[model samples]
Target: MTKTIVITGTSRGIGFELVKLFAAEGHTVFALSRNDKPVKGLNLDNVFTFSCDLNKASEVSEVAASIKSQVESVDVLINNAGQFLKQEFKDTKMEDVKSVYETNVFSVFDLTHKLLPLMKESTHVVTISSMGGVQGSMKFPGLAAYSSSKAAVITLTELLAEEYKENGPSFNVLALGAVQTEMLEEAFPGLEAPISALDMAEYIKDFSENGQRFYNGKLLQVSSSTP
Candidate 1:
């Protein structure tokens, strides 16, 4: 009953906690990140580490090839790696928008496309998004680029679901509220959040396991309140 799960962005935050959560459950986990070292104190036998910059096409392809060689099928692929930027639309640099999209949107698409061959019937593809991405939700002053990039991720998730649902691997995006993580602190310094990365990781664990049964091509907002 141990599923083979591939998770990206395990260097820290929710993705790091997810590696621990899945490995503790005895699932075979492939943890991908730019950092070469595994998370501190997580040396479980079931966790395999791969160091790759997801924004780099060659590195992503190489890592995908290596994973395909080792595992015939992957039960879940969690595209949790993302970048956030804080700048008003007028002041935002084009380079910042492109950079955020490269990591948050294009990288997710690239990795998922490469790993599609390894996914079978009923597999799950969950990508992390943000509450700001949800239309008509709370609006922020300096998150134009970051929010739009996440919006693209949700749209991409819908299209992928339509394209691949018949074969396997239902696609979904989790638009999350503020979580207490380094990323959050970077975006909004000194703000306390209702949820922590570890709490989000626990919710994502259950969602990754049972989401396809009730939801696919859906953007499920994970937040306790408007943030």
Candidate 2:
């Protein structure tokens, strides 16, 4: 059974690895990233690479519309793209905070909203959040905008799951711990993570494909480190 999967932030890290993994498994994948070249460079037989800036609602809507026109139904949609702002709350500007939300919260809503028509009852929506976003978790310094925006999406996923529980398309959010990715390097320089990007992607790939059978509209804390 082949499935069509749509994933954002496909240019690098876990999203990039997931794209390749799914393509290798012979699934159709719509890969969205600001720089499409990375996935496009793969030239996978089943992948449709799109250059998209999630910060812009129009771009997210356009991508969803394009995907809607092509796929009969979306089996899974992964909101993997995120904006990280490593600034203290006192020093962070209003524009910086808005930019973070534009990608983390607003874009997730826009893409999911537009793509709902293409998702069937069995479809699964997986959103990638952060351990920092988890309430009462050990707070990190200089991530007020980024962490809060992630929290917003977590709530959004929960609400969407409840609203669609009677219908279909299970929604879930993953609060991830430290993973060795470019984003991690940027956020915490010289820090080593127990998990690699590929490792985490493998977990998410499996979860996106089968986790809905066991859980919906739930937040799963996926961290190897204490948070």
Candidate 3:
């Protein structure tokens, strides 16, 4: 069966890789991103692309409307869109914090709430979280806003999972560690030897397909040493 999948932030990074993987596997992939540029090398017939700034609630509503018109049920939803502002609490502007929350937390909640009605029983919803979400990192400086937002996402993921546990869909948060992506570069420049996006995508694909059965309602960590 060709499952209907929705993935956000498909313009680049792990989200882009995930869209390609799912689409190539013959699943219907609705790839959402701010940029509508053509994805090179994705020749799959099952892929559909949409441009929506996740920071705006109205744009999210528009995307939801379009999805409703075409797809009846979403088998999986990957909330992979996020923001990270690596500034100290004292130095971080209020606007930057608001923007981070809007991108990392608020938009995710809004989109999930709107599209959740379209999800059937046993549908899987995954959110890309960070290891920083689990415990506050004293080792790293200047990431208070980013880390806090991700922690909020982790909480939201757990709440949603419990809310839908008995009769509806499943939800899980993937707390990834040190993935070598543009976000990493933006957050921590000059850091070397992070996990590749392809490897991260493969891990995510496997988890989405099989790991969800056991790990639903849990925060699964993915790192270089994680098995």
The local distance difference test score of each candidate is: 0.91, 0.93, 0.84
Best by lDDT: 2
> Cα miss at 188, model 1 (Å)?
1.4
TM-score, candidate number 1: 0.97
Off by over 4 Å in 2: none
Residue 47 of candidate 3: its Cα lDDT?
A: 87
Per-model TM-score versus the true fold: 0.97, 0.98, 0.93
lDDT computed for candidate 1: 0.91
- Where does candidate 3 stray beyond 4 Å? 38-43, 136-139, 225-227
Residue-wise C-alpha lDDT for candidate 3, range 1-227, written one tens digit per residue: 88888989888889899988887788998888888575534666788888899998898999999999998999888999988788777888999999999989998899899998898877888898888878643336787888888889899989998898887688899988888899888877766535888889988877776666786688887766321
Best candidate per TM-score, number? Answer: 2
